[model samples]
Target: MVTFFEASLDKISVHHVGNQSQDELYALSEAPLELKDDVIPGLLMQYFLKPFEKSNEVYHLMHSSDDLALNEVHHFATMAFEDESKFHEASEQIAKHLYKVSTHPNIKGGELYVAYFNRVQIEGNPLDAIGIFKSENKETYLKVYPDKGGFVVDYEQEAININKLDKGVLIFNIEKENGYKVVVLDKTTGGQDAAVYWKDEFLQLKVRNDSFNRTNNTMGIYKNFVTQKLDDEFEMSKADKIDLLNRSMKYFKEKETFDLDEFAEEVISNPEAITSFKNFKNQYEEEFGYPIGDSFEISDNAVKKQARVYKSVLKLDKNFHIYIHGDNKLIEKGFDDDKSMNYYKVYFKEEA
Candidate 1:
């Protein structure tokens, strides 16, 4: 979703925000940090931008009143984007707002970094962006140096892991009226209770229902229908379920556009099952209060990402696991009355 191949770090402010429920205070820097080393900028860019390289979901800043000017993070980001002089001060406001929302007891106090970036690439367009990051977890590292002939182990120092960003959001300069396009990551949140404050309360993000998200969500819904809901309404063996999942993935991979009716006839191929599946998809929209159109363009990136988690394994007790990939018809499930045991038979023309 984002890259920094042509990006440069313009300005950054560091602050310490504490949990409000524990009466911890927030400390802010008066000015932005001076980048003394040229290599330091590159490392900072990696820390800020690398996590978002594989992300496909995009979001926008929003408020309850539907007013863009009232969103704190969006407002501060706008200020910095419009005038470079306001970057440091805007960072201060962002830190304060984060402190105000860190009210959950499980929320840990940590270092917050608000940075202004230039020429950050999103969707192949190099646009200016504002990045807000927080490090809530740390690890101890030991230094080994040469002392005489042998190396000496030095004292331990606690530091943040650049590869493990706990929380982050990158707001692009485009789409000002509909809340600037945003991408986010949060790795250290312990529970949903504490998780909402970061993306929901602090940043106030809404998932952009574009091709990527629509494609991703639709596949997810179908996967749920096959793996979870189908068993309640119909009697389907594990092999049948795997076959259905395989068919769904095949349809997505082979087609450029997705139509509900087409998918049902091609993948499900049963009148009653198709109606049940469509109703299940509709329930998700109604329950979640989101609309998914009946047809839309498919996103290959979303399909690839979703494929990683789709299960193709069928486990039989603790003894064996059948990996169903090519043809489900080749496997057969049977019960032996004499031994009173369940068994599966496999058929293959050749063995690797």
Candidate 2:
């Protein structure tokens, strides 16, 4: 049935060509003739008919039709193409290439590596796919599939092992020079001002003043005086004295010292007290080096109370800087009363 249908169509085309004039034949050579009806004799004459017998125009028409048919076939094949199948096939070929590359003896067992795709537009459409893998030696290979868009090539460093279940996944072998060692730092808790210092192979923390307060609330003793005024007499009632003593004790127990510079700024604004208060202030300076703030209260029924909170400082060697992750938390009771906590695991990477 198919052969008969094709033969009938062919016969109609030939009859149409047999009846055409020389001018019509030339026009048909420039463009394809649109068949408007299925009348066998009409189309054959329009396409195949010619003024001269055994004209070369007949050959040109046949060639033109053949070229058109070939183009249509190619278009249909490409339109029916499946990207998933191409991806699977490309992945298999990449696996084979990786396997060949891994057999070399110089490859390392746990180094991370990547593969890049250099081809574009396969089978008439854009071929943006990549294949990622790990090299156990220069011969053993493991594939890594990213759950994102983009061709599968161009894997690098941490991205190479992001999908691996085992930490021991082979990153690369010693034979390949494309892989480099990577250092990943911990991004858990702490503020950006918090830094790490290396001492005897151990990573120590050197927190900033604000970050220190966020992690340690001991300075709450003097954070209550931002809005209150104190009397000149320095005398306190029984209850006020008790409150002062309790706060003082808590401050000393928590910080063991106070910041005197911060204290003098908030209290004793009189220049005359410089001589006498100098000695008392120096005592705190000797311990904490600086004062963050002072707390004072006004009272109608009794004497007012006051106290001071000091700032903290940390010193470290030159090889390290502070690195805080995006998800850290800062706790604060009041001004100068703050603490930082590491709720998640902290990671440290060696600086190269």
Candidate 3:
């Protein structure tokens, strides 16, 4: 694995200020003595000489001692002093060479990926050059021209809406126009702060301090809905009330054949009977193809009997409204309180 220190040094040397110093300039009046401690020579050694010296194969390939190679290095240094424009161009060329050699297909077990420039806008003529190189693991290296404005990269292509430096993790959102995609990244421990690079601007997304807690709360509600359990203690932890309401509706639909008054009485009086009634209802449905009609009466012998009684039949109401004989208190509780005597109110259509 190439360490960060090696990568940083390579980046610096590529820009070609590896050995030049601001404090002193080499005097042209130097006598033709042994030039052992030359600054430019030291810089050349630091950038290129040392690497080739360590590897004899590379040294021979580059022909380091050749008169042509020495002239090329000297010519590059002279241009750096005489022409600022040529200096920048030479620096860029060196940087490109260094990058090409040092950046392998896989660095530190991660692939190197590049984002090519689809279009460019220059003052006079556009240089259709490719843009920055990025590691598959989110390491970034960019080359920019000082003369032209810097390049702009839109994360829209990556499906990322926002990028945030939260502590040491690169947090981002991968969202579309109205849909949400997931954001995932590796976490670093006690390292340099992570960088968040968006499309030349700060990303627009809120970073929550307790993102884990929020995520847990959301997942809890989802679990509750799946389990059909209501967690009323925590407000946000509760699933949609509609889920519970739907379960209640299903319960009523299955048990609707039972006399409501008897069910209310059994629920309040002998709650165990409610369990038996439920089991019986399940068995009855399994045996019989259709659900039994409402208004079956529980006889004195505990046998079920169909009632033939008729009253003023009402039209079908939107809400579930079943009439069962019960006292005022039971009626006041809307039959929720089970102090009611069981009676059946049957509705039969009159023959036309």
Scored by lDDT, model 1 comes in at: 0.92
* TM-score of model 3 (CA atoms): 0.15
Candidate with maximal TM-score: 1
lDDT of 3 by residue, 275-340 (tens): 443444445445633243334422211111111211112223454444333221222212323655
- Report the C-alpha displacement of residue 62, candidate 2, in angstroms: 87
Ranking by TM-score: 1, 2, 3
- The window of 10 residues in a row where model 1 has the poorest summed lDDT is 154-163
TM-score of 2: 0.15
Candidate 2 segments whose C-alpha is farther than 4 A from its true place:
1-201, 211-238, 245-282, 289-352
**RMSD in order of candidates:** 1.5, 33.1, 29.5
Ranking by lDDT: 1, 3, 2
Model 1 ranges with Cα > 4 A deviation? 147-150
Q: Give the TM-score (vs. native) of candidate 1.
A: 0.95
**Candidate scoring better on lDDT of 1 and 3:** 1
Summed backbone clashes in each candidate are: 0, 52, 0
What is the lDDT of every predicted structure here? Answer: 0.92, 0.26, 0.26
Count of backbone collisions in candidate 1? 0
